[model samples]
Target: MEDLTPDLGDDRTLLLVDDDEPFLRRLARAMEKRGFDVETAETVAAGKAISTARPTAYAVIDLRLGDGNGLDVVETLRAKRPDSRIVVLTGYGAIATAVAAVKIGATDYLSKPADANDIMNALLAKGDALPPPPENPMSADRVRWEHIQRVYELCDRNVSETARRLNMHRRTLQRILAKRSPR
Candidate 1:
């Protein structure tokens, strides 16, 4: 892969915000190898501080951080540096949140397990050009499981409430939640 340095001019700084420490470290290293000066934060407070103190030219933020939502950080970065490219990554991808992220100034919204290449492509994509389809798109089963999980979380982990909202039997919902996620 070619370095993105020249394409981005001198502003090669990148911010990576995620609650997953291992993922954050790995992504930071990958972005650095791709010619970015990377900085990482594991909480919303830290991410906000970095955005306010010294905004980067590009950012990849996890949607659900330990302290707060990543959209707040995206908004701050956008307000501080309007030209910055921001991508929101989430394990629980949903239409509503994706729209909200864009409205808050994110350049793109991607589902979790997205690779460094995907993130780089998102940041450097041309105006109004749609990102290419993911090489290994999530399976239908996986998508369904993710949706169920999202609803489960939204219902505050109340199994009965989630089942009711999804029009599913409580026992069935419990069984699904008990199983591991499909690929």
Candidate 2:
């Protein structure tokens, strides 16, 4: 597919923020190959500092960072550069956080592991047009696992609290959490 590199402005600068070092490096390289001047950060603090110092025209930020929520960086970027196209990414995709990201000025929200193509498309998507559906959407079991994991993270990884909130037995929740996510 042809890249949709939108001419948002003269600034084709992109910021990529994620805690995953290898993923960050790979994405930065990919975006650079696509003609963007990419800057990267591994923590929310670093992301926020870079954003505040120099807000990029585009950004792909992970929802959770080692230091804090990526939403904080998003918020800062939006405040500094209102026209920026910012995409929020998360391995633990959750509706509440997606909505929150959008509410705070994210251009889009995508579940990780979103590819460079997907991230670029999201950043460049024009107007209100919806993105094409994923070729390989997650299975129901995987989705359930992600939801449980999200809730668990939100509850500070307290299995009992997560189970209570989910109205599931603690042991069952434990088993689910223990096992690898279903494909």
Candidate 3:
């Protein structure tokens, strides 16, 4: 495969993965202006495939994907392209999740509503410093479980309310929570 990392005239390439089309297009254009040859993927599967086929200098991944967690994509990239730097983004930002992404080999994490400049700065700083390892790995399932618990708590254990908040069915929520609880 051809080199996907842009030269920037300085020799670096950036890969961006997000399910948001508008955001991905805008960010790609912006990065192109800054001389980054940006390769984009709209799903975790696509991102993993692309990263596996290409040599990336850096990667920016969204935490939530259409098919899987963004952290999973980052993990695959980290394992496949160890020299590439990775930054994870999320709209549902949580310290625990961010730490988990880092623990899984992300170079940094950014909450949603991040600006282009912030993204650029992060990409530029990719190789300058390394983030400390996470205290513990956060399983994607565990994070989802925590989200379910928080929603249940907020809804006062009302399955209907929790389901409404989660955009799921009350029965589904009940089943998930039941599975999470001890027998």
Candidate 4:
């Protein structure tokens, strides 16, 4: 497929944050072809550093990160570069998270593996050049439930550990998971 990444040269800049290195490189290259000056970070810490150090026109952040939540990165970007549009992408797409993202000022939320067109559409929509995309093709609630299951597995079913890793309270995590589990 033709690269849709913008070529910014020295002017415009776009920040891409994701733990997936291969995906990051491919997306960055594609975005670069579309005319944006692309900068990539494999972790939330690196994303924060880039946001603090440079001016960015837009940011595409993954919802989960190795060191921290992608939402944290979105929050940082919103605070540091309010004008820079933010798009949150997650493999575990969830309505609750999507709502949270919008509440935190994300311009859009997407589910992975998102394509170049998805990113392009989000950017254009943020600039008021287009309308919001259709409702997520996948069920957000189901995705959230699956994510909770993963967390539970990782924590060995220890609610506290899962909550700690997710940056949520033990009670909250338990409550969410409880709701998802069958009767």
Task: List the candidates' TM-scores in order.
Answer: 0.82, 0.77, 0.66, 0.67
User: What is the C-alpha lDDT profile of model 3 across 28-89, one tens digit per residue?
Assistant: 88777777878999998999888878858788999988899888778778888886778898
Candidate 2 per-residue lDDT over residues 1-183, each given as its tens digit: 886445546788999999999999999988887889899999999999999999999999999898889999999999999999999999877799999999999999999878887888888888898777777777999888888988998899999999999999999998998899899
At residue 177, candidate 1 shows an lDDT of 95
Report the Cα RMSD per candidate. Answer: 2.9, 3.4, 10.9, 7.1
* Runs off by more than 4 Å, candidate 2: 1-9, 145-183
Candidate 2: Cα lDDT at 91: 86
Per-residue lDDT for 45-156 in model 4, tens only? 9998888888487889999989989888888888888877888998876799999998998888887767876786787573546555654544667656767777788789
Ranking by TM-score: 1, 2, 4, 3
Instruction: Locate the minimum summed-lDDT window of 10 residues in model 3.
Output: 2-11
| Span of 10 residues, lowest total lDDT, candidate 4 | 2-11
Candidate order (lDDT): 1, 2, 4, 3
| Per-residue C-alpha lDDT of model 1 across residues 1-183, encoded as one tens digit per residue | 555443666889999999999999999988888889999999999999999999999999999998989999999999999999999999977899999999999999999889987888898888979778777887999889988998999899999999999999999999999999999
Give the C-alpha miss distance for residue 103 in model 4, angstroms. Answer: 1.0
